[model samples]
Target: MGFTAMGLAQNSISGVIKNENNEVLSNVEVLVSDAAIQTKSNENGLFELKNLPIGKITLIFKKENFEIKSEEIAIGKQEQKIMVVVLEEEAHHIDEILVSSIFNKTQNENVVKIDHINLKNIQNEGAINLSDAIATNPGVNVVSTGVSIGKPVIRGLSGNRVLTYTQGIRLENQQFGEEHGLGLNANGQESVEIIKGPASLLYGSDAMGGVLFFNPEKYAANNQTEFSVNQVVNSNTQGSNSSVTLKTSEDKFKFLVQNNYTTHADYQTPNGETVVNTRFIEKDFKVGTSYATSRYVADFRYNYNDLNLGLPEEDIEDARFRTPLYPSQKIENHLLSFNQKVFFKNSKLEATAGYVFNNRKELEAADEVALFMKLKTFNYNVRYYLPDFGKFETIIGFQGMNQENRNFGEERLIPNAKISDIGFFGTSQYKMEKSLLQFGVRYDFRIVNIHEFGEIGTEGSFQKLDKNFESINASVGFKTEITEKITSRINIATGFRAPNLSELSSNGVHEGSNRYEIGNPNLKNEQNFQVDLNVDYNAEHFDFFANGFYNSINNYIFIAPNGNTIDDNFVYDYLQNNAALFGGETGIHLHLHEIDWLHMTSSYEMVIGKLDNKMNLPLIPANQWKNNFRANFNVSKNIKNSFVFLQANYTFNQNNVSEFETKTGNYLLLSSGIGTDIELKKSNFNVYLTATNLLNKEYIAHLSRLKADGIYNMGRNIVLGVNFKL
Candidate 1:
């Protein structure tokens, strides 16, 4: 019987349906268990079921190529209830859909080690940037100049070896520099996924080290429009961040837009002293739209970012503002992309194309531009899923990129160059009841052309230079269930990386790093072979995991001092050698079913990088241990989802160092936070307060570029954040 017959108030439930990548899925069937209510999602992946009784009920969501999701929801006396539902692709089905090359299977079924971080869970963890959020995962670290600049380091590798993808496009914004950040904002992102092993078979050159994938936020439910505002304030840097987002969806179209701005002053140290010129200002805007049907899907996205970064100087005047002085940099980036998917009766095809333009200018004086460069890149990819043959699922893909770099300033670092790449790959997976086997192979070719330029200083002018590189890579992996509670994965992969433009043509001092760098035109491609193993065990109240990897690289490139001086600066030249790196991470989570609100977790990670001569590599992160205790509770009728957490982090002394690096002492850090969701009249809000480095500890990190200047990391920081929805 309907609620109207009983004279009871009718409530409505509405929500959006999405995949693991946060992309909307259309044609989904939404049904209420033990009821006659049923509905189908529209092209925007939005669904609604109205005229429901005020009670607890189960909602089932099912679609082709995706796993069926069932959620139990409580309907109050309110007129409407809004929700966001996420569905994962089915890996064991004949019509499985691929979210990404790294996340093709479930976490337990994948051969490689992958970690996922939900932004909502860590929003109150005192993270200021995307890198900060990612660092919470085991075996993941950050190389930083200061709080304003950070780069992700997976295992023990970074720089050109690590690849980042957003909006289904590879990001290229002069990532070869040590002082450059990721050029992305943490706002408007749903989650982040990290692949800790070689992924060159899927992403080509830069995937030799690892891959970082950012998932965008989903659209609003059908016939609904919503907006949100978020604000954050930090005491350490006197920083303020604000962002706003608006999303809406109709029957066949969905749109989302967001804008964010951040400003900060010099960060203070534990000793009550501020680090001068360590401030930055950033502005970002993003817009996206999607259209989906039963036969085809189309998506478009654009992002614009502007940054003003300060260069650290010794003995500079301290101020609580972000006005960059001399020797600063201004960078602007624009990215546009379009993606399409076609579904047939028994097969599917996907295509994506993207373009990025980066403009960077460095000022050494009030009115003079020392360095100005522009980088333009175009990327394209296509993949086709073939019909299932017997018990195997296969995919064939092609990917390529065309890039150009131009200089327009007085100082020239690397010559103008054009780069082109092409690659072809195929992969297959066989799924069984107790075991899964996966393998893939790829071949890539690259060409680089450099234009001649006049010589400067002791470096000779570059003649017309042309180079070509080719590589064949492959990977084989297996996942098996040993018992009802244990699982294991074993993988062997080969990856390669071509030398970047700076490593091939630099001829002068890099002012940002305060070192004279020389390039090696004769350098060859770096090749690596690695083996990874992962073991996992799960019980009713306990979870444990261990991951290990060993990598060997031929022709590994590094910069070394040549025992010479250029204008009072030490001269460093790029060199190549055979190198090896081995590392492992382990963690355990304990929860008591009797006390479901209490949880305890601990983890440890260690890595070592060495050359063929037994010399350690520079900038390797120190071994670290982390432990956390959290409690969840409800305060009263007006407050819910309340939680308190305490965290302890300890870093072991780094005694293993390169000849050019120094050892760092061990230290410990303490952090804590509390947050809750508040219910108001016709609205809801979230508030959080976090304290980092609660003890005001002073410490130096091994991977911190500022360590050379005897500078300590940021001191105690108190952060407050609030979110409002309308």
Candidate 2:
């Protein structure tokens, strides 16, 4: 839930490293993965760790031209130990240890398949925002309104269907609207793990679509201090992003702080047209601290974000406005999280409580706040890890949230409401020789209370009401290592989501959507069941994977035009129906054995959604094929870890569309980049240059709201970045 390093070492451990032939292996790397502790073997092939916590920890050893090795060990409260370690002279990939997904189990050992991407991989692609960064992954897409505002779409489900968690808490912004953006920044971010199917079995409701869990940067090494600075410049929008971070950790305490600032002008299209009122500015700040002993651990984290985003609904005659123009959105968010753990002799308890406040405003003119809303959410989770039994691991948890939404200003879209949710779940895993079985069951109860607003019987009016929803869900999964080089997995899960305020009681024209919408008060819950299958083949020089899923949903809610107009706005009605969606992703990675430094990757992804009546679902991404070829090598003694890459992504034409949507033509996007790491003694620096939309193809994306206005996405942008560390 918090940072991974939970150290409580009270004793000392020493070890000696050697090769198979019993020769001392100097310069070997030894690490405690979860504790964020590492040391290099001296010339004598000896390493020592002082004051380790009294628990089971994974010790990993690595060296050049050698296979990675790991051992699980338990430390006593008061003990001194010495050990010997031996390595084999071969090279192989090591599975990543997951922290939040399923405790400390590696990816291969888990029954549920997940997708992960390092934040650096996203940055190296020159992504300007988190939404764009994650969209590069398979089975993921984004619905964009402009260059500055985009929402993540997973497996053709978006809006209130999917759930997002940051800092181990649910991120609640005004995301019920499709025009809203993910209120997140990458100031102190690390990597992200994605559960591609129904995750309600773990994270409760609204995760029927899936879950996006973001992990923050790990704490600094014990007894060490670190500082870094990063800056990037963009050519298309004349944008600039800068950030600074400082972190320090001691034997029993840790602290970290970071800040980020970003600004941009209007983005230019491939046709050399500047989209008016597309500028934005952002400021972000973060702080974190932790304390731990052998049996107790506590962590606290805080973040603040402020943003001003322009909305390009019309042209602005004035060209001198430096900040956002009229019809813009200003958002401010604050997050505070506290985590604690209590360890017994054979079991442990982990609990995290978080508070989030979001302030959102839409301005229509000079100093005019047409629509303003404030949302406050308090969420808590507690999980108890039972002592590991032979071939069995079990966990029981309880999760709940209390959310309040209030409105101000002239526009009233939804009524003021208070929503509460509580859920209890238990899950366990059974390990076998070559196969693993995992299952879980969850019970959820939710209540929504709406307060009346505006005049009775008029638009933007609501009556006082209260409603309750409950559900019981479960999941079963199995993973089998069919052969030495092959693995297969299958999972079946059920998920459900109660109707949101916007889908239940809204009766007005939403901001920026150019439509009059009406909600159905009697809408039922959306329940879904999905089956997922995955097969992977890993060999010496190649890796291949194929994934497929079929999902069936009941009481799916959709909005469509009813051939009528209210106040010159198209009248749309929210409707419900049974629906189905099926999709798959396949990819292959090849490392050139002869070339040694060259690698190639290719992948394709597709999804199709349909109602019971055979009508296509709206906003589904088109079929895609992506390819990348890269080379890595040491440039010189001073410049090391240098690389170059060429990439191409092709989006196939989308003739399949809903009645209210338009078809889009096919297009190809080309991009390339170069970068390197520089090490001058104790100081380090990194610099890179990347270009996107190399061919400047001016095509409208199928999922972009700007397509209705005949606007093209950003094109031919160059980004230059630099980093310095001390």
Candidate 3:
């Protein structure tokens, strides 16, 4: 019988659920008694079972496609209420070990999903941004000003089609500005989640490509204050960076503050020649605060950053590219957000509000008045959900956003643009014995108002315009477990994206890409329909997953070569074009051995996309794959509290190339690292050294946005880093 019949005292069992690798797992089904009382975990891997009788109970922890676990738990009348649980990957048979990489995964009969890249992977790479770490994934590539400014490009989609976020808040960078970087840093972050294929059911608009969510560490435990620091030095460019973080939490309050600074010189090629070397300086600061009571919780965060990075510039008179564009890539950004939650009985309500401000300045490649731009955005959202409504749960939400874009340049005085959108979203989920069904829908109403400023030379017309857009997108998905160890999932989703400023008013040289891009005023929003499927299998010692997806776009806005035009100058216009898309990705993870004190993990991913029945799509990579091997060893006699890890990754060459551009040849890059941990009096110290492009391969990636003559990825770089935790 359920709890009410038992004359039990009020108490709780609270704790975080983790895997052997110390990574959190969400939605793990925990059954507390033989009567089948169950509870699920939150995003942070936190869970609570309240109002339980103070007596002996049998606890059962089971998840779809995972081995069932049964344990005897005694609930003493005056015992502690919190206990941490760690689950181990089970093996299918003798001599066949299950693989459980640090990657997070969920499985059903038809679908297996993996979304998180943990700190273990992040520590093995020496990079400036989240994109650098993400690029290690098989189906993922980057389109950056150079290696240092990478942004994820899934399949054939990049730019406005992809969406990025920090924690649960939307990223505020001027993403529509193709020259801008994704800007999120990996320092002090716990992990990053990549939602591939069509995820429009949760995120709106740009889900056509995919979404990257960076999650920071949660609050510390037991009101204890903890500090962490990372210092890194790179050999390729003689660069260095450092990050510091402080976190603490009490029963009622929690917070984290982090700061990072980085400086790098121009990078080199395998031959050690400075290739269009540029210097960059960056600083980032973030603070997050949270408070919670029995029925109420609140969270707030503030992020700030300042960056000055150089770009390539071309000289009109000499037909030669210039070094270190006078303006450089200077950007200042600030973001603030607040979230509140109220709980009653079996339902909860959440409200979120945020503001983002960004400012950027860069010198024009040909014209004078330095190009400067500013963006201000304000957004709010409200959602409510109720659990225990029979076998189904329902969620409803509303969101609103307002943004203003301002541009200042010498050639043409483009007026500021105001953009606004309002949306409603809802999702419902039902669970059967071995299957789950989910349906979600979103409706958006968007408007844009533009004003013209100054005179438009005989080159083009200058006018004011107003536009409105209304659209509805929906998604349906199913996940089921065929047996206790195999699961599958399938989904169909639709998405829409509104035009941004860069696509509607730009008319100058884009220093970042070394291209003179002109905007089209008559462009239309793009829409997408997509379907995805996946499979996951978990054995005693091996875990693996495979996923496939196809996406098609209506009114796809692609840049096309439209001859040349003569104003006071002659320039080629890249106009918009319609197109269709299809692609998929698959990966598998394996765990080698534990008894021998050895652990091995490996994975590979493949992605493909074609447009208009053609094999070529701009800036999309074909056939990307990565193989990672890591070994952990402990040193007990020589050093106290010491361990070492050796890791390596190999990225295969891409075969996909654009028809409009020269065919890109494939290249192989290799990276490796080693780290050791030591315990000191009151703190812990960890040090590591990483070498990238270990073989000194000198080739360009097909998806790189580097200019044909300028901007080269760094070659043969070494990084030494140390971390102190207390």
All models: lDDT?
A: 0.83, 0.85, 0.65
Model 1, span 311-351: residue lDDT tens: 89775665547786567789999989898876555566779
At residue 68, give the lDDT of candidate 3.
52
Per-residue accuracy of model 2 over 3-34 as CA lDDT, tens digit each:
12232435556778988898888757676654
| Residue 330 in model 1: lDDT | 92
Root-mean-square deviation per candidate: 7.9, 3.4, 7.0
Candidate 2, poorest ten consecutive residues by summed lDDT: 1-10
Model 2 TM-score, 2 decimals? 0.95
Q: Could you arrange the candidates by lDDT from highest to lowest? A: 2, 1, 3
Worst 10 residues of 3 by lDDT: 95-104
Model 1: lDDT of residue 627: 94
Compute each candidate's TM-score over C-alphas: 0.88, 0.95, 0.83
- Pairwise TM-score winner, candidates 1 and 3: 1
